[model samples]
Target: MDSFLSALKISLWVATSSTLLVALFGLALAFVLARCNFRGKNIIDAVVTIPMVLPPTVVGYYLMVLLGREGIVGAPLYQLTGWSFLFTWQGAVIAAFIVSLPLMVRVARSAIESVDEDLIRVSYSLGKSKWETFVHVILPLARSGIMAGVVLAFARGLGEFGATLMIAGNIPGRTSTLSLSIYSAFQAGDDTRAGQLAWVLTGISVFVVYLAGKLSRSRWM
Candidate 1:
């Protein structure tokens, strides 16, 4: 019971943190991709989408290569501060963020693109700067889609398993999320515990999807 609660707590924390990041960066990238054209734009879009298609283990392996103590990015940081992401909850957050980011970007980009160009042009003709127009016009118009993306991203983060297992490992009371805990319980022949955890995950996922549908159908303004 105690372990179940702990795993639930960790899962919520990781999912919330990763979802906030996904919302922020995903909206920005979506806006940029929808509104701007430049060299290597397609390359950037493809790179962002890669995680969604690649196996989670492959994604985790790539993260390990980049963030391991002896790795290119990790080596310099480790030498300076002796800190590492390996086997930490923070590493789980990173894993969730990477796996869920593409969903946010894709949905939000489609939303932004669907906004009427005439409305944008009218905003511009009314003496609004591009930033002002985006703030006032584009965001409100795209709110439903963006909110749906956020909900999906949160659900994805909450359920992330493979990359999280590879990077964060399954250290009880530390990096073990609900998904990892479920796996551990099953491995230990604790069928009841695993069932309880699975039920909790299923309930949360259903609520998130319901909320997404509601947001997508209703307009705030």
Candidate 2:
């Protein structure tokens, strides 16, 4: 019981920080998808969104293969700084980020797609640079969508389990987040502990979606 309580705060911290970065990257990608024209854009969009439909375990395994100490990408990353990612809290965050990324990109793309094209054209005609138009014109209009994406990403990150397990493992007081904690309790036949963690996860997921709704709604009035 005390152990479970002890781990809850750690779970929150991992989820919060990881979701922040995931949403940032996702929003950036969404903007590129929404407004940019280039060859193979549709293909790029499909590739980015593939994870949303794939099994979380598969994603975790892929992340592990790339992020492992001896794996191609992971080897170079670790060698460059002697820092390891496997089974760490940061690794858990990476798993959560991947799991939530598709949703974030989707919402952000929707947000940017919903913007008025004429306004962008007007801005261009007025001699505003692309970066300036993005900052002053496009982003302001897409704020609600981006906020919605962030909330969704956070909610998704909160519920991450399979990938986090595969990549981060279930080490408590380290990488065991709320969902991982619940799974641990269940696996150990501690139904009571699992139930409590379940409630916590559910409550947090609901709150995050509610926050998303509020942010989207506030933009209208």
Candidate 3:
């Protein structure tokens, strides 16, 4: 029971943290892709979205190569800050963030793109700066879709398994999330516990998806 609670807590923490992180950076990327014109824009979009198409284990392998102790980014950062993301809760967060980021970026980009250009032109004519127009005009219009994306990302993070297990490991109480817990339970022949956890995760995921659908409809209608 304690282990279950710990897994629950870890899953919630990782999901929420990753969702917030996704929102912060995802929205920015979406905005840039929707509103700006630049060379290699299509390439950047494709690269940012590769994870959505790749298998989770592949993403995890890349993460391990990038953040392992002797890895290029990991080595320098570890040497300077004495921190490494491998096999840690922070690594779980990163894994969840990476896995869920594409959905957030795609949804937010569509929302931003759908905004009426006339409104932006009016804002500009009214002496509004780009940042101000974005904050006041674009955000309000895009709020519902952005929120839906955030909820979907959070759901995806909560259910992240393959990548998280590879990158974060199944360390009980530290990095073990609900999905990992379910897998561990099944491996240990605890079918009842696995079923219970699976049901709980399913319920939460369904609720989250329902909310996202509702928000999407409300925004589009």
- TM-score of each predicted structure versus truth: 0.98, 0.93, 0.97
- Model 3: per-residue Cα lDDT over 1-221, one tens digit each: 89989999999999999999999999999999999999999999998899999999999999988998888799899999998998899999999999999999999899899889999999999999999999999998988899899999999999999999988999999999999999999999999999999999999999999999998777542
lDDT of each: 0.93, 0.84, 0.94
User: Which tens-of-lDDT digit does each residue in 28-72 have in candidate 2?
Assistant: 889898888999999988888888989999898899789988877
Selected candidate, larger TM-score, 2 vs 3: 3
Worst 10 residues of 1 by lDDT: 212-221
Off by over 4 Å in 2: 79-82
> Which parts of model 3 are misplaced by more than 4 Å?
none
- The ten-residue window of minimal lDDT in model 2 covers 1-10
Q: lDDT: which is higher, 1 or 2?
A: 1
Best by lDDT: 3
